[model samples]
Target: MAIISWREQMSLNYPPLDSEHQAFMKVINQASEDIKKRHIEGMEKMFQACYDYVRNHFSHEEDIMERIHYPEMEEHIASHQLFIKNISQFRQEFETADTVGKKLDASQKAMAFLSVWFLGHLISRDKPMKPYLVRLRNLPPRMNY
Candidate 1:
């Protein structure tokens, strides 16, 4: 079962960002499945993918926020940073686990965190950016610059 699935309500109406979010869902769901199957060896790869998503997607979203002059950019970035810190802790737990049972426990904890965080971030952070993005696109070409 998926930790969470992509929904239309999650879309910011920006294809680039929306696509990234959708792909992120896939990564999280796959990680959840691996955990279910006791695929302990694959957990590291899943963690790496999550890390990569945080690195690339957070910056991409940040860049768009800069372009749009988002008022809450700092707070939004802080949330992203907090997520990085939280995920890093989980990864460390997984890595330092002395046995497969310990590793699976860590993976379960990580997935639980990811599921809650991703949905909450989408609703609290990204959804509000929809109007700003629409206005940005609607701006005249000269003014957009």
Candidate 2:
């Protein structure tokens, strides 16, 4: 079973971002299930997919923020940076554990970290961007995401 499930309340009413968030939720849920089943290979694959997706997603989001000149851009970017750093650290731990024959434990820890961080970030940081996104929605289609 998956650890985290997506809720409609999590939506920020921005299609592109919402779609990305939904995709993230799917990956995290699958990863959580893989961890619970002790499927080391599956977990590793999911982790790599998530890591790549997050990097791209964050870059796209930051670009949007920059284009919009969001007032809280610095804070938001910092948060994104922290997330990337944390994921990198978790990846390192996972790799080290695998080298030491502790893959299961490290995978579980990584999944747990991702579950908590994903939900918290979506609610606290992403939700607040709704207003800004809504305003952006008013612009021409090309300008909007």
The prediction achieving the highest TM-score against the true structure is 1
Clashes of each: 0, 0
**TM-score per model over all chains:** 0.91, 0.88
Name model 1 segments beyond 4 Å from true.
138-145
Candidate 2's residue-wise lDDT over 1-145, tens digit each? 6567778899888888999988888888888777767788887887788777777888888877876778888888888888888878878878877353477777777777888888888888778777787667556656435
- Report the alpha-carbon TM-score of model 2 versus the true structure: 0.88
Model 2 lDDT-worst window of ten: 136-145
lDDT of 1 by residue, 15-129 (tens): 9899999988888899888988999867887899889999899998898788789998999999999999999999999999999999999999998999888889999998888
Go through the candidates in order and give each one's C-alpha lDDT: 0.89, 0.79
lDDT (0-100) at residue 69 of candidate 1? 90
Residue 70, candidate 2: C-alpha displacement in angstroms? 1.2
